[model samples]
Each structure stands twice: as C-alpha cells, then as structure tokens.
Target: MSQGVEFNRLMLEMRSMQADAMVRQKPVASTPEPGAPSFSEMLGQAVGKVNETQQASSQLSTAFEMGTSGVDLTDVMIASQKASVSFQAMTQVRNKLVQAYQDIMQMPV
Candidate 1:
C-alpha cells in the first residue's frame, strides 16, 4: 500500500486503541453535599493546569534566550504556542462562567 494509506491505517488503529482505553477507564462519581467545593475544586484544577502550562512555556522561553544547547528552537516555539492556546481557552471558560453567573443572579427570585 501507499505511504499515505499506511499512515491513515496506523492513525485509525491508534484512535481505536484510545477509544478502547477510555471505555475501560473507571468513572469517579462525586458525592459532595450542597455548598461543598465542587466548583472550587474544578476551578482550582483548571487554574493549576494553566499555571503548569505557563511555567513550561516560561522555562522554554528562558532556555531559548539563554541559548541552551539541549533546547531546540522549534520545541520552544511549540511550547509557547501550546501555553498561549491554553490561556486563551481558560479565559473563554472564565468569561462564559461569569456570564452564566450574571444571568443566574439577574433571574427573578
């Protein structure tokens, strides 16, 4: 078969494997009571991920600036781009959450 066809087949196989793994994964059900920290916990986790991504980007930038021998420019660029995308996504989520909160607050009691 052609190289493109082989690559497509490989990608299909990888996706199938990923789907199977996801299907077999156990679900974690939360039993938090009302007024608990479900929202805070999710927000904290998202913020933590964003912070980690930002730190990775900062390190990559520093390595690039310091002319580190082991750091490739392409890798640094990719890391920075990934961090930027994640930051943008987080900002969008925050905006939507704020809008939802405002809408709920405006509803008649």
Candidate 2:
C-alpha cells in the first residue's frame, strides 16, 4: 500500500512537470493591426532607406571632390561604392517585382 502510494505520487509529480514544461514552451503568435501595410510596404520602406543611403554617399563624394578639408580619397571611393551597390540592389528589386507581377498575370485564373 505504501509502495502504491509512492508510485502514484511520483506519477502525479511527473504529470505536473510535463504540464509546466508544455505551458512554458507555448509559441507566441502576433496578428498585425488593421490598416497595416503588408510585405510590399515593408519592401518599399527598405528600398527608400537604400536610396537615402545612396544620396548621402553621393553628397559625400561631392564634398570629397571639392577638396573639402575633412574629405579624403578613400572616403570618397567607399561612398561611391556604397551608392553603386545600393543602386544595383534597388534595380534588382524593381526587376524582381516586375517579374513577379508579370508571372501572376500570366497565371491561369
């Protein structure tokens, strides 16, 4: 009778621990608010950031070319490269968006 009681107690403790573990491991899910923009909005924001970076880079290049006291050749080169990369990335994104739209249109409805 004592052994039976001990076994039952152990099983209860194990079940309680399992329940606690499961509760702790529950996944968190979030739903976006109404009127929130979707993936395209996020993508547009990212592209805008890139464009801003490119513009800053161009300004830096101009400053360097004008023989500004604080500007250096290396700084200008790096800025130019950064701007070029951003421009290329934006171009690629535009191309991909266009292609996706075309593919969707071509899909049989």
Candidate 3:
C-alpha cells in the first residue's frame, strides 16, 4: 500500500537526519569554528524542531477533524506518528544527558 511506502520514506528521512546530526557532532576537546553553534545551541535547536513537528501534527489533525478540504486521514496519521517518534527520541536524548550529568557529578574531585 502507498501508506506503507510513505511510512518507509519517512523512516528513511529520519535516519538521514540522524546521520547528519552524527556528522555534525564535535569532540569535547576541540574548539568550535567561528560562527559554529555550540553544543547547547545545537541541543536547543533539536528541541525546537521537535516542538515544531508536534505543533504541525496538532494543526493537521485539527484541520482534518474540522472537515477542512484537502486534509487526508492518512496524512494526519503519518504526522501524528512522526510527532510521536520524534518526541520519544527527544525524551531518550534527555534521559541520556541527565544520566551523563549525574555520572559526572559523582566523579571523584
């Protein structure tokens, strides 16, 4: 079905984005180039992206529920799934960050 194909495409897109993020990451000891975003800035941008995705999904669902023309059920479902996956990914990253922080704090001074 076309829905399955679309879902596959979305998953591929997410994987590519993850790869790009990995490529962008820098080592802790390196000095960032001028104008490059710092680690905190990058993290903030990622969170912003997740927020935007969720908002877009909400708007799409609302439009579909309101009987707006050109709103497809499949599209709404896909958007909702994308939002859910992105939120879960963000939550995992947050958990990892918290764990790292706790580990660092427990280090011998």
Candidate 4:
C-alpha cells in the first residue's frame, strides 16, 4: 500500500480503539437509590480514569523514547492525543464546578 494509505489505516485503527474504550467506560443506566454510588464517588472515579489514561500515555511514551521495538510511533501519538483530550475535558468539568460553587456562594440566603 502507498504511504498515505498506510497512515490512513493506522489512524482509522486508532480511532476505532478510542471509540471502543469510550464505549466500555460508559456506565450503565440505573435507578439512583440510597445504596447507589454518590455524586462524589462518580466524580472521583472519572478523575481516576483520566489519571490512569495520562499515566498510560506517559508509560507508552517512555517506552517509545527508550527505543523499545514493540512500541510503535503511531500508537504513542494516539495515546498522547487521548490523554490530552481527556485531560482537557476534565479541566473543563472542574472549571464548571468551580463556577457553580462560586455562584452558589454569592446567592442570598
């Protein structure tokens, strides 16, 4: 295959992997009850997942930098991008939460 075709194939594979990961990460819908996970627990879990992704990306990059034969440049790039996007998403969520807290603080009793 041509160089362009090969690159495109790799990109497609990366995207498919990302989508599958996201699908697997989604929680199943369930009725909220006293025994259910609290909002704080859910948020904590989300943050933990983001941290895991960043750590995974770091480890992959380290291996690639070490010239590991099993590490592919394309895989490293994909992992880095995934980590970046997830981090950005988490940051946005944090910003929104802070803003909401500030708004509530300023509200009249």
Candidate number of the best lDDT: 3
**Residue 20, model 2: Cα distance from true site in angstroms:** 31
Q: Model 2's lDDT to the true fold? A: 0.68
Candidate 1: residue pairs that collide = none
Candidate 2 structure quality by residue, lDDT tens digits, 17-42: 44654554423485655765556675
Backbone clash count, each prediction separately = 0, 0, 0, 0
Pick out the ten consecutive residues of candidate 3 with the lowest summed lDDT. Answer: 1-10
Answer with 1 or 4, whichever has the higher TM-score.
4
Q: Please, what are the lDDT tens digits per residue for candidate 1 over residues 23-72? A: 54444684545654455675687678778978998998998899989998
> 1 or 3: which has the higher lDDT?
3
Residue lDDT tens for model 4, 1-109: 3444545654575567447555545355855555555667767877897899899999999999999999998888877877787788779889999999999999999
User: Where does candidate 1 stray beyond 4 Å?
Assistant: 1-37
Rank candidates, lDDT, best first.
3, 4, 1, 2
Please write out the lDDT profile of model 3 over residues 31-68, one tens digit for every residue.
87787777788789889988999999999999999999
lDDT of 1: 0.71
**Ordering by TM-score:** 3, 4, 1, 2
Kindly report which residue stretches of model 3 are placed more than 4 angstroms away from their true locations once superposed. Answer: 1-29
